[model samples]
Target: MTDAPRPRALGRKSIRPSLVPRDLMGDEELAGVWTAQVITLLPQAFPGVLGESLTGRALQEGVWALRTIDLREFGEGRHRNVDDTPAGGGAGMVLRADIGAKAMAEAVSRARGDVPRLLLSPRGRRFDQAMARDLARRDGVILFCGRFEGVDERLIEQFGLAEVSLGDFVLTGGEIAAQALLDATVRLMPRVLGNHHSAEEESFSSGLLEYPQYTKPAVWEGRAIPEVLLSGHHAKITAWRQAEAERLTKERRPDLWRDHLAKLGRPEEDREL
Candidate 1:
């Protein structure tokens, strides 16, 4: 219904390199749109991957804030045993409900106070770019990363926690998925990415995967950037991008196409299936 973008504009590009990407050319920076608090058994897990990549550097510049909570602080005994066998004798241990709950409470207490508290679990809400965009608009969020089998179900019910799952499959711990969620969420914040349009045009930005992108020498191994991109025709370029996105969705993700049409209120469009 609209070509206009969200109203926030970019800030000056002259920020010190300490607060900006070293190689980023002069461009506007988005400031103070989000803060993130991550509660994890392993605080070291983050900045390991995030530090070297796009999102990590975004943190360095103060475009966003990241505060980590060490869940082991709530563990029992000196060894900080935070997980135990399930009461019914499951093969794997479930992260202790009480410990995790205590950790969650302390994490929220230490967080910005107004930020939303969320536990990263299979039981959590389904994560998607739309959801990512939604969460990024907030002041900040608290993320609880689980390990072993999972955290206690009672604690989740008690706190009315919002469950979030990365996908159908399971991972070793929620920390990685939390990071993935963090990366996806933070990138949508006002100025973390060099180009504001980047977030607007990426996969799921408009309910479709992105059009193919190409750069440089134009011709390489007989494959060239789409001629439409180089034609200097803005309308044609836009049309080509949209058509390619639709085509890619039709071929690779018919489900998305169905949803796209469903959103348009055209039930008859289901015939494309």
Candidate 2:
């Protein structure tokens, strides 16, 4: 007869020896748990907002894991310098290729499975809900948080890192962007959000912005909850939500509206309404 599957272990995984102190480590690694490995100079900046609310709860429960690899630990010399003056006489310093490679090697060694390695940069592909959903479906992710003028081009090419941007703007560093990316991706993981439907109904899940939401005190000030929502008619409520989602998308995000229309095989000009 076939043997029964082995039961998974309970509780946090054991601490692995590292230059990073045990206490500063955000969460203990857990077997089979989805993990985010961040390679950053600011190791202490992690689990910032991620350590609260539903994501935090899920983290403590081992539904997901976070590990920050201190990039400075891989630096060279007595001062532990990770960056150097740019080669072409630029105003800012660039993270040394060697230092980045060392840190990435350490991160890669601890990686569990087919984790997508990403580098946060202003010039990279714009991050969005679709990318977050794609990441949520993966085993985990490895994020290289860039600082200063960014890392050596050779290192980026060497690691084959996919560069991602939070928006069209720039940041002092990638730590914030990394956190934002992680927050968006982690919430989509199973059991991370209290309600599964929350992810399904939220903005961008359907290629359009989410419909407006309202709660109790049915009538507030001068406005009342839309009658259709209060009517308890599921069909009408769904229709109303769809219409609002489309209308909002068309008004605020014409780019998204055009894409949505294209998907429906409708003319982009038909977005007017």
Candidate 3:
């Protein structure tokens, strides 16, 4: 009798050189899987929280992939220096343009397809759910995590890097922001989450903050689960959720509420009603 067809392995083929040992790399290079390429000084900082829970599970399963390009690997000089003092004189060192250009060139060469090369910066466009959704639909992304004061402007310009920020505030490095951005983007990929509906219903998916959720313990601390949720009426439950979501958005985020209204072609004045 002929043997049954073997199940395909989820692992990917390793296409690029890495400082990480092959065995510890978890998922190998798999074509078609969404990937995140990170350029950072602290190579060990990743997979970080991305290596836990659903995102971690996805990484292991080859549903997605992660490749960390150590910036220090491309550092100049015998000591492997990657940063220098600001040209006009600044309080902190700036990443050298020459070093950054070399690192970026390596990242570009390793890209599987046309992908975004992002720089995490305090002055860049604010990251949001829409951006996450957009990235999730792409082949992958290359993130450059800046350190010290920041990267040289010449490097940013030469590479045409898109600067993205988590908020107005700054951090010691871009590693944390890169992780956060990856977490947000990766979860939106197919099969990453246990239930696809989770992404569709989460906060900002509908252009409004998510409604509060309750589970079990029909009554908690003298408060009961919203009666509608207990009624077993699907229509009523959905309506209640939509109303609550709108109420929360209108009260807590006027800007979002206005945007939501505008999307629906409603006038801002109607929000008062």
RMSD of each: 8.1, 5.5, 3.9
Which should have the higher TM-score, number 1 or number 3?
3
**Which regions of candidate 1 are displaced past 4 Å?**
1-33
TM-score of each: 0.84, 0.90, 0.91
Error of 3 at 82 (Å): 0.8
lDDT by residue (tens digit), candidate 2, 25-99: 454567777889999999889788988898777776567888998998988899999999999797999999999
Greater-lDDT candidate between 1 and 3? 3
lDDT of each: 0.76, 0.87, 0.87
Predicted candidate 1 versus true structure: per-residue lDDT over 30-113, tens digit per residue: 344366778888887765566656676676555676667788888889899988889988698988778878877775665553
TM-score of 2: 0.90
Count of backbone collisions within predicted model 3: 3
Tell me how candidate 2 scores on lDDT.
0.87
Could you arrange the candidates by TM-score from highest to lowest? 3, 2, 1
Better of 1 and 2 by lDDT: 2
Q: Candidate 3 lDDT, tens digit per residue, 117-217? A: 89999999999999999999888999999999999999999999999999989799999999999999999998888899999999999999999999999
